[model samples]
Target: MDCILHTERLTKEFKGFVAVDKVDLRVRRGDIHALIGPNGAGKTTCFNLLTKFLTPTSGRIVFNGHEITHDTPARIAERGVIRSFQISAVFPHMTVLENVRVALQKKLATSFHFWKPERSLDGLNARAIELLREVDLAPYAHLTTVELSYGRKRALEIATTLAMEPELMLLDEPTQGMGSEDVDRIRQLIKRVSAGRTILMVEHNMSVVSSIADTITVLARGATLAEGPYAEVSKNPSVIEAYMGSASVELVGAH
Candidate 1:
């Protein structure tokens, strides 16, 4: 399979410390690749580098056969790589429909026209509603963003990112801070949304990651501990020691 995103010896350094240390990663076209790690494992740093939020200290980043290591975030985004934050990132003062409309306007490159109402943009309202429905937020389309529950806000974030029409999505802990029911809902939404694109996410929830990840890469102390299917990773001694060892066994069991 062709890799839509590939990094060769990708490294990031902060002063004297190495955050991401010479890692090689490949995300195949249309595959949902999960990056799993403990806190401070440099997963977010990797995403930032890939998105060109931070320039890599060393190594190369290629997207669709183009060397994009030095590209700007907007340039990278223009090439169809978009990231959704771990924190809910929508306009709290805006209505649900308006929030999605903002995303649509940006995607349509109509954000410069301050005088034009969203309805005036070509296909804007219809496209916004379609994205809302895709994320299961159409029912609350007219409600204020602040009125929606935390879980729904996350869903809205996904919908907004989808409105960008990206070919590859980088999701940072998409289900963070949600209850079991909400987690399940977002998990299903992720699977639904990723049908035609590549998805790379940093997730700590084992059951959720195991259930949906087409391929899992385990990170430990800023390096890959294991990379393979969940079943293959589950039995790896290094992965077990990093996450399910005796010290962490109780915590894993509690979940």
Candidate 2:
């Protein structure tokens, strides 16, 4: 398999607590992978370690065959590893189109040049609108971000992430607080936009994971408990006990 990203003995520690312990993750190129576990299972910590948001105590991270364990978050982003936050991260006061344009500005080398005339950014509008259309937010492009529904706001966030043209997009909890309809919408949007890219997501929605993720890694107490497809990992005894503490409840399509 062609792995776009992988880690060897990736570990992180805080004082006496180990947040992430010796995880070996292999994310195949062009695949939608999921990291899942109960709360505090080190899913987010693993993400931080991969993105260089947090330093690893001991490990090596390779992206597209280059070791990036010591790279800064900016450096990682430059290599096309972009991450979205658990919370909605758009400019709430700005128009939806403007929010996406702001992200696109970085590609134009004008992200920090506020003194430039606003029309200097007009060249980015067409691309920004295309990103919005990819996430189904083009119809809401003229509206202020604050006026959007929560799910639409998340969709806009995806648009902004897309503006970065990420090779590996790490989405943290993409459907955390959405209703069923919104969850399905975001799920479909993710599927649609993943056509030519790789996605590694931290998600608790089992149905979403089962339907979309090509691979699933289950963590427990800062360690990998299982790694495989949803059907295989969901039925693993250790993963079942780690999640529900009982064999009766199935993990597949539970949400």
Candidate 3:
């Protein structure tokens, strides 16, 4: 398999307590890989390690054939690994078009001016509009992000992430806090955007994971307990055991 992101013995510790314990994770190019686990599973820590937000205590992270363990967050992003935060990280006061345009502006690396008009940026609006359309937010381009529904705001955030032109998009719960319909829309949007790019997301919505993930990794106690296609991992006794007494046992779409 051609892996765009691979980690070897990735470990993180805080005050002598292991958070991610020697995790070997591989995400193939063009795959919608999912990381799933119950609360306290250190999934967030593992994500931080991969994104270079938190340095690993030990081990290495390779992306697109380059070792990036020592890379800064901006450098990691420059390497085409972009992460969306758990919350919708849109500018509430800015229009949807302006929000996406801001991301494009960042990509151009111009001196960021907080008070500048969107039109003054020159050559950003057209690209931003295209991105908004890509995420189905074009129709709402003029609306301030604060006026958008939660789902629409999430969509806008994705449009902003897309503005970076990432080769690998690391989405932290792309569908979190969404209603059923919104979840379905985001799932379809993810499918659309993932056509030529890779996606590695931490998602708890099993239905979404089952519907979209090519591979799923189940983590417990800071280590991977099961890793495979959803069909195989869902039936693993240890996976079920780890989720025992948890809502995931019912919610997971392994069956």
lDDT of 3 at 16: 96
**Pick by TM-score: which candidate is best?**
2
Candidate 2 residue 191 C-alpha distance from true site, Å: 0.5
State how far residue 35 of model 1 sits from its true place (Å): 0.3
Steric collisions counted per model: 0, 0, 0
Model 1 lDDT tens row, 1-255:
699999999988899899998888988898899998778889999998999889999999999999999999999999999999877899998989899888888887888988976458646778889999999999999999999999899999988888888999999999888998999998999999989988999887877887888998877777777888887877776777776555434323222
TM-score of 1: 0.94
Taking the tens digit of each residue's C-alpha lDDT, what string does model 2 give over 1-255?
999999999999999899999999999999999999999999999999999889999999999999999999999999999999998888999999999999999866787897989998888889988999899888988999999999999999899899999999999999999999999999999999999999999999999999999999999999999999988998898888788888877877654
Ranking by lDDT: 2, 3, 1
Candidate 1 vs 2: which has more TM-score: 2
Q: Which regions of candidate 2 fall more than 4 Å away from where they truly are?
A: 253-255
For model 3, name the residue pairs that clash.
none
Cα error of candidate 1 at position 97, Å: 1.1
lDDT at 148 for candidate 1?
94
RMSD of each: 1.9, 0.9, 2.3
lDDT of 2 at 30: 98
